[model samples]
Target: MRIYNTRTRAKEDFESRLAGKVGIYACGPTVYNHIHIGNARTFLNFDMIRRYLAFAGYDVTFVQNITDVDDKIISQAKQEYGDELASGAMSPEEATQLVAQKYTDAFERAMSDLRMLPIEPPGAYAPRATEHIDGMIEMIALLIERGYAYEVGGDVYFEVRTFGDYGKLSGRSLDDMRAGERVVVDERKRDPMDFALWKSAKPGEPSWESPWGRGRPGWHIECSVMSAKYLGDSFDIHGGASDLIFPHHENEVAQSEAATGIRPFARIWMHAGLLNVNKEKMAKSLGNFTLLKDVLTQGYDANTIRMLMLGTHYRKPLDFSDSALDEARAKVERFANCFRDAEWAVRTADVSEPSEVSELARACDECETEFRAEMDDDFNTAGALGAIFELVAALNVLLKEKAGALPDADAADVRHAATVIEELAGVLGLKIRSNAKETAAHAGEQGRAALRLPDGSAIAPDEDSMSSLRDSATALGLTVEREEDLVLAVLDKRAEARAARDWAASDAIRDSLREAGLAVEDTPQGQRVTPILSSPRDLAHGSS
Candidate 1:
């Protein structure tokens, strides 16, 4: 495998520090407020990278840290609790804890809503900065002893000049960076580029007992300490957003290497590109930043959102637009339908064996190889997806030609092809479920029952109505056979409506099915009821 290293500024063969194990540490969110869509992209991209690595048979341990303690959290906490304090002004610990818990819960819920893979217990190991205060103090003490950091007043600052390789990761000369330094100038620092390692506690603010007096570890030092504590002084890969390369990541390199005396803190450094809106950087200050929930609530499913984010290569600037999302939705729908068709072929196939192998057979046989080739080259998800789409196209052609049934061998090939497509998609974290069937099965008794209107009226099962219904069944636990029966019954009812020329009822049912994630298409072989994956919005939630 190959990966682009931000430190080296080139793509290099990806080899873990250990033979078969890879440890990755990605900078996680600072729990302060609801994360915006841009933040979601960063998290999702790293998740994809982690998933792909594990998929390739590597023993991967992914670590993401939560910045529960930070300047932003402290300020926000003060604003939220200071006014409510009746007695002594709210303590920093009390306020920070309150805000951290609120936003941490919010971040967890957002990740769940986005359908991101769990980063705990079998997923990535998420560490809280506050939980590793001891580790931070130990590292800071070592840096000071090693003549790499110093203390001034109660605060401890990293002596940037002490580490000769200060700006290597960011490729900036120390003199050039100091000249362009726009950070608030601290008068006590030996150099203008020196940064805080431990911050002196202000009155009524959260602080830890450190040799440098009561203080909290600085942002850069926290990551270095936590990462080393969990992933050792050196690990396979370190990842974060490109924006962190300059100051945040560069500082990490300096602190970790200086404290541990390890030359390379991490073997590989990967950074995902930033997200933009209307060709402008998505920022809260810009007032154009959209939250992930905003888009999901607007009727896009997690799968569609994932498609939109992963459609472009991870290193390319992905412009978030409704048009791009729509295109992604269409592609997702197509992929889902292709899978459905392949499954149908397998189910309805009857021939004992094929005289000659089909094109789909070859496509399926080559999928893993082609997919791995694309991913091995810097995790080119776009190219990998192209390979999956090519197979999808082949399967579609085979299904179209072998409409009625397939020979036994042909059926086996088609089934293998379908499985390969799903396997490859899973590597990219694109779970291609037959949305309608899954929704119906998972939607539960109340959800399935709610398919009817309050007025006791019905029509083609539209996409809108079904989406609303499915949303209500989030995290549903049900049976596929039951959902299949429910969908089949609805399809039969629609067929009856059409046979009787009851256009309104037929259309309503069709629309409802479409909304519910079932693709209702009229084929020459009669009406084909294929479950189409729609957005996260309820099938009946906002339908007209």
Candidate 2:
């Protein structure tokens, strides 16, 4: 495998410190508020990287930190509640923790919505910075002992000049970093380029006790300390948004290697590109805020969001817009349709010695090989997605070519191809067939909404309303057992109304089905029933 090393600025052969083990740390959210789409782009891309590594047979240890204590969290706490809740007056620490936990919970929900890799040993794998204050203190002390850091008042700063490789990661030079020339430097520091390792405690902010009085870890120090604690002094990869390279990740390299006496803190540094909204940088303070929840509210699913993000390479800036999501949603629908059609062909198509089954399986194998090739080229996800759809298009042809049940061996081949499709897509952390989970979860409420249509006896598929579905299916000359089957039966009844020129009845069928989280398109092929990827219930709740 070859990975682009940001530190070296070249693609290098990737060899883990251990033969089969890989340790990766991606900087996670600060959790001051719900993450916007731009914030989620980094996490989503890294999740894809992790999934691909695991798919390649590596025992990957991935750890992402939650910055539960930060300047923003404290400030947000003060702005929201003013040091008091309905229960009573709150302490400064209590308010900060409250705000942090609230948004930390929000971050978790957003991660789930995007189907991020399941983090195990939740606490250790997703450590909070506040939980490792002593580790940060220990590192700061080591840096100070080595003359790379110094304490002033209650604040501790890493001395930029002492670290010879300070700008190696960011590719900045000492001359470019001269504070008075191009940057602003704190007056208390010995040099303009120095950065804080620990901040002195302030009146309404969170702080921790250490050898150097009470203060909190600086933003950059939190990741350095936590990653070293979990992934070891010298691990395989450290990653975050490209925006973090200059000060945050560069300082991490200086601090970690300096304190540990290690040449390289992380063998490879990967930084995902930042995202924009219609070519404008997305920032909450600028009123350009586009929360992930709001995107879901606009009736797009996590799958659509993932497709849109993967449409661009991880290292390239992504310009997001509604039209882009619409295109992504269409692609998602294409994949979903292929998965559904392949299953239907396997279940009911006439049995015959199909000419294309072996070819279909070959297509699967070729897609997998090509997928690995694309992903291996510096994690080129856009190219990988192209490989996926090529296979999708090929599989769709095979499914449509045959009209009857496949021969036994051929059916198994088709099934194997479907399995391959699911497996490869899962490597990208996408669900092709499991979308039914979302469909079923919100059936009850959407069923109620469907039943509320004017003069409509729509099929409400909730268990309480199953009898209505059964009667409707019987009237339509169908035996429906599952929710999807009932939806098909509804389409049959809707087709009946259309055939008889009952325009109102046809309109009611379409509207009622749409209300129940299904879309109906009267194509030349037939009345196509589609389960909307976005759930009405979930759209009410939560993004990228």
Candidate 3:
């Protein structure tokens, strides 16, 4: 495996410091408010990389730190929970806790919605900065003892001049940094580049008992401490957005290495490229900030959003646009529909000579090989997707030649191909929706015989409506058949299983139906059946 190391500014071979194990720490969101699309992109990119690493047989211990205690969190908390005007009713400590939990919960939910790795045990562990305050204090104390940091008036600051490799990660020297410096520096600092290691708590703000008096850990100190506590003083990979390459990540390197005397704190420093809206950088001040919910409103599922994000290389800025999302949707639909066709051919094809090798089986082998090769080459998801699309095209060709059916051996080959597609796509966090043919059949039949949308919008089509839908399908070279009705019947049975507390039975039924190319979603009202569309759009539209 190869990953582009931000520290080296080059693509290098990836080798875990510990054999067969990868310890990865990504700078997580500061729980201040709802995360925007830029945050989503950074999180999703690392997630995909993490998934791929696990797929390659590494025991990955992924750690993402939640910056619960930060200047931004404190300010936002005051604005949100404090009383109007000068101060809030709640104290800074109380407000910080409230804001932290609110946005932390929201961030976790967004991760789940994006289908990223789980945040609990047996998945990625998200360590909160508050929980690791002791660790930060200990690290800061170590740095101070090593003559790398100093204390001043209940505050501690890192001495930038003491660290010989201060700007190595960002490839900036003290001279280059000074030339473009903009922020005002504290008069007490030994140097203008010196950054705070611990901040003295102001009145009504959150604070912890430390050697530097009652204060909270500085922004960079929290990450260094938390990452070392969880992933050790040195780990395999440390990742974040490209924007963090400068001050944030550079400061981390200085603090961690100064405390531990390690040459390199993390082996590979991976930073995902920033996200842009159209051609401009997405920012609140620019009035073009996009949230995940906003994209969902455009009829895109989390899967589609993820697919769209992964379409661009991880190190390249992606310009978010509706047209780009539409293209991703189309690609997802193509893969889903192709897999559905392959399954049908496998189920209906006659048994043939088992000894003979099938062309489709060979193609499946090629697809798997190609997919792995592409992924191994610095996790080129774009190249891997291209391989999947080629397999889809091949399967379509086979189905057309066989008149939608194949011999028994050929059917098995088709199934193998479909399974390979599903497995590979799953690694990319792309859920291949079932019942593509049905979804296609009902593509333009929206609101006809519709029960309800995922958002609670109702659609009831009577006899005339059904007739009109059928006419529209015919005109569009589609067929409205009993497949949908059969799907509903299966969903009804699955719902019964759920009602009876037969979770195993219900899950099995859902998987069985999905393999057969039908998407069965159990909504709060009842089971809603739809043609398997790639987008997990809510069923309220009857086209999810």
Candidate 4:
């Protein structure tokens, strides 16, 4: 596999330090607040990378750190309550723990909704920054002893001049960066470009006893210490969003390498591109960022959000908008439907060995090759996703030609395609599952039973009741299907034809439905047909 190394600014063949084994450390969130969609993008991108590696038959150890202590957390807590000890006010420790757990739980829910697979076992080894203070202190002392860091007052800062290759990853010169130093002027630093390794703890804030006195770790040092402690002095890959290339990752390299005397802190440095909102960087300061919970509450599926992020290349900036998300939702729905249909065919179809099946298998293999090749080349997820879509389109054409008489081999190819897509997606932490008829049936029954009206009327619906409802609707010459929880009535026969996989018939049905103010969705349980309203309609009347 080939991956783009930030250090060289070029794609290179990936070789693990240990044969067939990979150790990867990704910079995780600083849990001061709920992570926004932009922050989640980085984790999703790396999850895909890790998943791909493991799918290719490698043992991968993925470690992502949680930065529990930071200036942001302290500042947020102070803003929430006037004083640390105010009655009913959350203390700094309590605030940090509460907010961190809440956001982490929120993040996990978002990941689960997106079907992301966890690389490590649940809570297996997610080391928090506050839990690894001693490691950070040791590294700092080593840097200071080597003259790579200097203590100014009670705080300690990494001396940028001492590290000659400081700007290698960012492709920035010290002088050029110094010119922009006025924006980040820290009077305590020896040079304008020098960044903090440790900050002196403020009064009534969290602190750890270190060689540099009572202080907390600097932003960059946290990752270095935690990563090195978990993955070793030199690991296979270190990844984060592209924004970390500067002082964050660059300083990590300096402190890690200077402390351990390792030529390169990590063999590969992978960075995903930033997410943009309305052609601008999404930042809290800009007041245009969308939180993960807010987006989920707005009724967008988590998988839809994941697909939206994956639609763009990992190394390219992605533009976020409702239109983009809607398009992504449509595609995801289509993919899910295709997989469902293929699985259904597999279970019901007769065994067959045909030349067409072999041809389709060849096509699937070629698609997988293209997908992996694109991924190997700098983790180009956009190209990889395009390859999967192309394969899905081809399978759709095959199903159309065969009229759902998919041969055994062709069915296997379809399954393989799904597996490959999911495996690659796993690298990005996307989970794709194909639910068969039995599971769908049970879920439909359970879901319907859970829906209760405010008036306490039991709307008990069985298959017979559903069939009666269908017949009643059909008497009006309307197509309909009754599932446990839903009454799917097709206002147009053409729409039913489409649901039955008759494209021509379905197209005609869609036009007729549109004329009759109806829209259709082919759900797992059954066809979901609804009337399109110009304005919102009350659910009590069931007219909408």
For model 4, how does the per-residue alpha-carbon lDDT over 136-205 read when each residue is reduced to its tens digit?
Answer: 8888888999999999888998998998888887889998888855656677778888888889888757
Q: Model 3, 388-409: lDDT tens per residue?
A: 8888888788778877446676
Q: Backbone clashes in each candidate structure, one number apiece? A: 38, 5, 10, 10
Q: Lowest summed lDDT over 10 consecutive residues: which window, candidate 3?
A: 436-445
User: What are the runs in model 1 whose C-alpha is more than 4 Å off?
Assistant: 86-90, 350-356, 436-544
98 Cα displacement, candidate 3 (Å): 0.6
Superposition error at 161 for model 1 (Å): 0.6
Q: Write the per-residue lDDT of candidate 1 for residues 1-544, one digit (tens) a residue.
A: 9899888889998888898889999999998887888889999988888888888899888899999999899888878888754366666788899899888877786676556778885646888999999989999899999999999999898999889999999889988997887867778999989998999988767899988889888999888987887789999999998888989999999999998888799989999998998798787668888877567545566667778888888988899877787788788888989997877677756644433366767777677788899888988888888899999998888888878856777787777777888888888877785341222111221233323221121112344554443442321222333432455556666788889999987887777666675567776456755435444444324574
The TM-score ranking, best first, is 1, 3, 2, 4
Off by over 4 Å in 3: 84-89, 349-356, 434-528, 531-544
Give residue 530's error in model 3 in angstroms: 3.5
Q: Which 10 consecutive positions of candidate 4 have the poorest summed lDDT?
A: 436-445
Cand. 1 Cα-lDDT: 0.78
As for TM-score, the candidate ahead, 1 or 2, is: 1
TM-score of predicted structure 2:
0.80
